[model samples]
Target: MYESCFYFVINMSISGSLVILSLLIVRQIKIISRRLLYVLWFVALIRMLLPFAISSSISVFNYLSGLIKKLIPVGNLFDANFTVSNYFNAALSYSPMEYKTQRFEHVFGISSCIWLMGVCISLIAIIVIYCSTIRQYKNAVHLKDNIYEDKTVLSPFLLGIRNPKIILPIGLDISSSQAVHIIAHEKTHMQRMDNLWRIIGLGTVCIHWFNPIAWFGFFFFLNDMELSCDEATTKTYGFAKKKEYAEALFSIAGNRQNKNLIHASFGKSDTKSRVLNVLAYKRLSVFGIAASIAFLLLVAIMLLTNPKV
Candidate 1:
């Protein structure tokens, strides 16, 4: 068990490094299509969850690993002959000299226990927050097909995973153009199945709670998700309608309430950036589209593979 825990920590460390690299790349290419940005974030999330991948010499981790090998006595730190089970059995026999020699294994067992405790606490907190949020929205009044109005909700959002319902604030004018944009935005989230991805991203954060980079990755993922949805929701709008969409976003932003990871709320994240993205929106030309695809493929190959060991 201690060995398994140690490997899990190592995997998470590698994934965190990938997250940092992805963020830096995204920052440099901020003008790219936000959908591509979201996809890159999704790839990072997958890296955090999966422990193994195809190793490649081109992977950045390969260079980092070589540097680490130079700085640390890797062979001495992890002896090929040492096994966790053997260490524990020797420990139980109460041999003082054996115990003194297996100090590293003893420390590893304690560290594993601490990691397990953190995981349990993180999971419990997630469950409690989700359940509490659900209970608050339980009395939402169904207005029409898959749409509900709630007096308590400050802004419109899509709730639930398997059977999502768009929840609108009670005072929203459903016939107005702004209301149309808001509804369209929530519908876009449903079409993208963003709530599912959001859940997965959050799960990765919970598992890697000790890594601050993991939290940063999750928040950036949410921001990109919202930006991408905004782009999709307003893709076909004219200048005037796009301006109206920005206004709709601003109005929703004013009424924004506490954010819930499970709920895909319109105007819940990076409102200023979303507004700018909407106003600055331009359709990609054929050449531009091709370039974007090429860039995405490059990012996938560079970030998704493991170091050749």
Candidate 2:
């Protein structure tokens, strides 16, 4: 059991680190829209979820693993029967401790337990945070179906898993133009099922709590999601309202509070990116749109699948 868990964690961490590297590369390409990056992040999420992937000879992992195997011959690392003597033998090349005092199985069992405990702690923390957020909004007034107004909240956000609603802060009185932009942005989130995605991302983080790359992926994924939603809102209101939209973002930059990770809000996670994307917003030509779609599809295929051995 310990050996199985060890391999599972290793595989998960490798896939997640690959995703982080891909994201870093994609970030340097300015021509790609945030909408496309949003889809890419979703593909990464799918990669993290499905353990078994369709392998291909052209897969990136295959080449990387081949190079690694050439440099460090670790062919016996994943043997079916991983014994204590094997570990002690490997440890001997480094600094070997007392042989009788340490058993490989005991150490492996404890390490696996620690990983499980981390996941449990993450879930518990999320639940506590969610309850606390709800309690803070207890005095909120229902303005409409699935919408609430609260004085405590600094910016607008959507909270709840089932039938999530848009929330607005009571003192947030902006011009009608700005409100229109903000409302459209939040509505676009609902239309695209972003709140559900937020929850999914949070759950993924809980499962891969040991991987720092996964956490970074989650943060950047949320930023891309907001940027994508901004792009959608731009498309809806026409590119002519770009200046107004950017202004709306600036006006709502009031609160820098760390929101519940599970909630989808019209808050600023990356204000500079949002404002810059807004200012540079332009509708893609028909051919450009088609090309973008094809490029993202190919990227999804490469990022989500495993390489043939």
Candidate 3:
């Protein structure tokens, strides 16, 4: 009952946020590929798999086991029984009285060991990146109402956690550019709540906590998002104006002198891919979009409603 309730709350929080995000995507900003958004959603699922504690310390026991097995002298070395028993005791703080539980945990062999180690690594990476990203985000300055304010001009990232606002440097002004397509591009991120997507991707790192596939999924989703946003910008402006958009992309990217931790600047290292995808936009048939939508919905429904977990 408690688990059900907990899962329900998590589900509600996630769903509610997504609904708000989708509404913002529709009304406030434009997006190209909805399919890409779904891929990001997958990355997010991988991130939030388990809590921090269990995943965090999997590596300690793993290392201890390896160290003892490899480092102990042949005559003085503790054999498997002593080593595993000691590890269980140390990792779980088990008392000699709790022999049954200790035995069970100690008896856990290679497969569980490998899986747990993977989880710990994934969790650590996710956590480290998350904190770093937060610090970066907090550093960028937010601009108040100016003529540029109407254009949704986000500043380049600044440094550190405190007093971090998006920095609109002296010469590099996105809001003032002749190509208005850039505004739609960044606004699409805000409207779709790309920050939440980032959280999800990071969360997957925590969940899978060890899978390279999860990291790949995150990058793929991010790239797709950029591509989708590019498509939307093209649709809003026009395909023939690709060079203008490309030039604007170049300008925004070229001036990124500031390097902050992770506030997710408008144009980051993704500058090249974003420009390349804009030039590569191809019109999809009604059937393609429909099928992709169906796939995403089906996967989401199955994962969400399945009772077994």
Candidate 4:
């Protein structure tokens, strides 16, 4: 029994440590250390799978050992005690009776310690980033109301903490050609509640501090969001407006200077991929839309399976 419990604790810790190691390797050595990450994945799998197999085998072995002891003619000198050794002896730490409870309590500690460490790291990151964003937002200036006469204009660091307001240079009138597309674009972002997702995503990462899959999942999620938004904006305005939108985007991107800690209002740094997705996008067929919805549902299932922190 003692040996089995020890095995389970070891197995669980290895499972957890490998998850953390995968993230650290990605951060530190980039692709050079990723092969080791694959090995870690295999190690994690074995650690998780072995316990049930080993427990079943050990239980059978223990039964056989007990049976063998019973079959023998026992004398004081020939005594064969097969009792599993209690890890805690009164001579060491606990009273003899306490060992029964202490073994399980010990295993539980391993999980608690791991979760605690993750929590600590997450809290510190959240606090730091939160403070930084607040500082930027406080320092931002409010510019005059923008009127789109169907022209696009490049603006600097436009942000609105409350209400609809564009923060750019004073006495500027964006061309009617560009203003129409730009207004539609920025307003769509505000309407979709994307700014809320930025906050929510950051908070979630804190809780899931140990999962590497979460990071990649979030990166692609954000990128796809931009691509999808671009698609919607372009499709609504029609293909004729693509050049105007693209040019506006390029101009803003060139002048875009975000606060050090705040998420960019326009899009992230993957402009090349965003440009490709925008240029390549074709109108979705009914079947294609249905298939895309089905894929989203499948991913939702995996997310639902995870126990929320």
TM-score of each model, in listed order: 0.85, 0.84, 0.50, 0.52
Residues 1-309, candidate 3: write the lDDT tens digits: 433323333333333233323323432223335434645355235323421111122222233334221111113353321211111123343345666774664554443555556657866775687676554434334454221222223444222233333334434455555334555565555555565566555655444434454455555556565666667657645656887888777877765545322344556657887777777766667986787677555544433321210
lDDT of each: 0.76, 0.72, 0.46, 0.44
In model 1, which regions exceed 4 Å deviation? 63-101
Which run of 10 residues does model 2 get worst, by summed lDDT?
A: 81-90
lDDT of 4 by residue, 222-275 (tens): 554455667777765555567667766675566544432234245334666556
Worst 10 residues of 4 by lDDT: 300-309
Largest lDDT belongs to which candidate? 1
Better of 1 and 4 by TM-score: 1
TM-score result, candidate 2: 0.84
Clashes of 2: 0
For model 4, the superposed segments whose C-alpha errors exceed 4 Å read 1-121, 124-128, 139-141, 144-172, 175-180, 256-264, 285-287, 298-309
Candidate 2 lDDT at 237 equals 57
Better of 1 and 4 by lDDT: 1
Model 1 C-alpha RMSD vs. true structure (Å) is 6.4
Q: How many residue pairs clash per model? A: 0, 0, 17, 10
The Cα RMSD of model 4 versus the native structure comes to 14.5
